[model samples]
Target: MKFHNKKKKSSRGRAKWHALMTIIAVLMVVGTGCSVGFGQNSRKNWEKNIAQETVQVEGLEGEYTLLFLTDTHVVIKDSEVSAQEAEDQESRYPMFVNAEGVPAEEQFPEWIQYANEKKVDAVLLGGDIIDSPSEANLQWLKEQLEALDMPYLYINGNHDWTYPWEYMTDMGRERYLPLLEPFMQGNTAFQRLNLGGLVILGIDDSTNQVDAQALDRYREALMDNRPVIVMAHVPFMTQSALSKAVEAWNSPVVIGAGNFGGIYPNEESEKFISLTTAADSPVELVLAGHVHFYDRDVIEGEKNVPQVVGAAGYQGNAVLIHITGTEN
Candidate 1:
């Protein structure tokens, strides 16, 4: 009986070894196949393009360095990103444009260098990570961010709303949200970062309007006594129906055409108004980058509340902002 038992034990061990080998072989094949597939689909147009100018600015209230990047406007995948290119650097974000557009990749390096020199605590990307929702590109983006020495936050823009809702499959939903899950874990509306005396918030307005719950989160974050910095991709307000109707009719009473702010409030406008009106948070500075236009508005309807716009920091058309505030 003892000899028979020893033989059975030996058979079980051999079976386990075979199973492990099978898994290893399958993984290797899959990895190799993916590599080949990626190489074949590389976009030549993007590889050659580089941004020459840099976007660098100081924070509003506290001594902080903030890097604001937006509108990559194209898909950048594993095949396009060369590890050798940034071997010495901790993180790499390849900026690109589609065919027949102005190139900015070469100028982008200057911005990175400027950030390192400024010693910014965090990097803030104001959305449109991909021209469209490409899994390979999004995954590559996640990996690139993981390499960053400092923490970074991402907001969403209109371009990212192309999730093919018509099909609405389980796989499709999974593919869409998970791509942004890395940045949307804790809060839905905005993320607040408090570094020493500097308070920074990254907000999302891609889908138009802010959720009530998300507004509450931002409100709660402001409970702490520090100057708040708001960063979002789109304007906080837009034209009302009355304003739009006036624009269509060309009424002289309507001033400044339509107000290009925050996606033309309907149901969401009330929530936004409530959030902004509630007890003034330490939000002395507001920075945004959507609409592709350059305009500065002073939001001093109330005391200690200021909002500014910074967009398109490029040659012939670029802007950088500087703000200083006291602990009043």
Candidate 2:
């Protein structure tokens, strides 16, 4: 695939661009007004906030860099939403702000700008790209992503489909698939992107569960013998990551470790976990976010694959992943 700076011409013309910019500016101003005293020192300068990690892939031919972002809970309401619903969405803005008090909707554009400037091979949006499935949020997300200079893969997060007042359930998630399908590329459950010797698998474990079809697709990917990197909304269980999550949230908020407190995985999710962390598993890295803090640890299989849990994107947290091939 081509990895170059190519600006996507807007079909909506300059009016749309100006309108989007106006909205973003208003959000930044509102965010600054609320937390200006506390976050004054933390504004702008996206490069300084990036956390870097590297992994070695045995069969890979060359080095690849990916900008991984997650949990950017942006809320943009349009006319379709009720006034009460809009107010509810606005109430959630403060939770996702950074130290500088900039909301996710504002910080997201900067993150995308950084990615374009750096020109990474691909961008992996692990999930929670928006606060809900509102028409405005979906439209804004599509515009920003389509404008990217590099390729990107997006999967659903629990928050992406659910409204501010609703509980996250399978029915709620399925209710919005039609709205989210444009971003899913082909399959809503799983999607794969090939970058030379590397294979990136994006799974919709937004609800902390995986179905049989996703498991089957994962199994098929393993058969190809390519070095794999899995990205999802909820993280898998590991000793260090799990402990940190429990301490932070007072519950086990990860996948495959619900025995500690959170929802237990179903049979298919269990099988998926088993395959990913198996002794002979080809998965070299796992990327996820949901607990809203950065944690890195080794999943305890015989191989001990590295897992990196990115912090919340709204707080200006991002991971710059460098994948180097072992084979010269």
Candidate 3:
């Protein structure tokens, strides 16, 4: 009986050793994967190499001037971390700089100075407010915006959805909405900014999910005869494989597509196209920024009116648009 007990104890000891080895091996694999994944994702090259330029367009010749800029990808590294140390962390998400993460007041002093000098009636932040909603970054951006004194509006971008599953949680987005709400007269979904004679309609294009109530509000604002300006983060085109493969993509649908369905999906582009094509009101311009490069397209609408997509400010340069209202 004593001999049998010794053998069982030995067997149990071997089993424990094997289990320990297995756990160690699994941990090593996971560690390697995380190291590679974070390294690959942490290259905020887009933020560092941004180009800032002001493009002035005199289309409608209106009394009010609106500034269109997007894709700043700002980042504010932690206080204890070196800027270089935070570089990798910044690259992992969009808006590399935190709104409250960095001293935006110092980083873009010229931008603020220019806005003051230009005396812009309204500054329309196209989208991609921050690389991610780092608590510090959001607060920082809000502080800077509050100091602006001039009117400003913010919408979401693809990067705002950098959380798990590439979607910005409702609560996360809502937290920052209060800071931007003052600039906008009414709600967050969409706002009809009445800047002098111009009617700036800022639309949320960060999600593919189309809020019927928001769109209805937008339509109501557009019905007015004043010149209409639309701002969104992503282009209203379904450029994804699933959308293109099934012939689900088209111009009419893509133009009014929202950021729903995940990164240029079929539903968004189709819906976008349908809206732009069917828009009976005078939509003087549609400004979008998601593509890092600058591009311009003129679509002839009713009464031979032109719908224009201005260049993106990915390089950190704001697109300065000056509209001169032509006498009828």
Candidate 4:
């Protein structure tokens, strides 16, 4: 009887050891391609806009480096932790740095410090500024970014402009515009910003629709015939290695022929990709974020312009685009 008890105890010991090993193996693969990725599904039911012939870009001024950050997903709360906070502790990454996790309010200062060190001419936020569009969340993010000494621009993602899985429509987007109005540099859906000789055309393609007004701004910027940088929350196409690999194991349903790989794959997005892939677009590079990983793809027709999707902004990863005669 004593021998039988001893054997059972030894078996339990081995089981515990195996479990520990399994957890360690998972940690090793967490940041690699084998991990599960997250992003909102595409808005296929929404009305699609047809793409018009893209205009040419005006002559651009001197060279500059643009600091691009996206998918920061900052969410701040009082000291008292909620049920969501408890889940965040386990699911959110690098909790040690974030302390509170998710938004990691404490880490904002560090990001700002890094931007200062990089001395970028401008800061571009590629959306997912907050995990959810709550008043407190938006206000906190605005205050943190407003403190930055340099000019910063932003665009909204599905996570920022609408409730999760919400329909893609003008009324849907309008509901959340107010949440971002405090920090919106321009009241329009898209911005044609001229920083000295550098021209930036930012689009609020959160719902996958770049309405007529936004497209008009894009044309005006193109009419300048200068080098323009296109900034958006999600990639313009589903043809990316990063998306293909992640979709393999993470979430297979999120990407496909018609689907834009977890982003809005509507007519506007297709047109943007088709147009910007040419030499006449003058789009030096495209910076976007949503999949929470860093990936780059060369435009099919225009080998010169590259589209760089950065890693999660919350993890201190940023893409530095050195706009020059050649691609970086």
Per-model CA lDDT versus the true structure: 0.51, 0.83, 0.56, 0.62
Over 1-328, each residue of candidate 2 has an lDDT whose tens digit, in order, gives 1332223344456668899999997788667764443344445544337899989877678899999999999987465679977687768867887887777887888878889999999999988989888888888998999879998989878888887566576677567766888888867789899998899999888877875568888899988888999998888888887899889999888876877887688998888878888888999999999889999997776678788999988888999999997756
Tens digit per residue, CA lDDT, model 3, 10-123 = 999999999999999778766665444353333222232222332223345546666666776656556565564366445653433333333222344445556777787777
Winner on TM-score (3 vs 4): 4
Show where candidate 4 strays beyond 4 Å.
Answer: 1-61, 78-103, 165-172, 242-245, 248-264, 302-304, 325-328
Best by TM-score: 2
Clashing pairs in 2: none
Q: What is the C-alpha RMSD of each candidate to the true structure, in Å?
A: 15.9, 13.8, 16.2, 13.7
Tens digits of per-residue lDDT for model 4 on 1-328? 9999999999999999999999987776663535444121111112111111122233444567677778877655534556654455345334323212333455555567666877877888888767666566776787778778788888877676654434455776667677676566655368656777667878776655554457656766777856778887755553573455456446422212345344444666556665666666777767777776666765566545666777666665676666544323
Residue range with the least summed lDDT across 10 consecutive positions in model 3? 42-51
Model 2 whole-model lDDT (C-alpha atoms): 0.83
Superior candidate under TM-score, 1 versus 4:
4
Cand. 1 TM to true fold: 0.58
CA shift at 249, candidate 3, in angstroms? 16
TM-scores for all candidates? 0.58, 0.83, 0.61, 0.67
Report the poorest 10 consecutive residues by lDDT, candidate 4. 43-52
Given candidate 2, what's the lDDT at residue 186?
A: 62
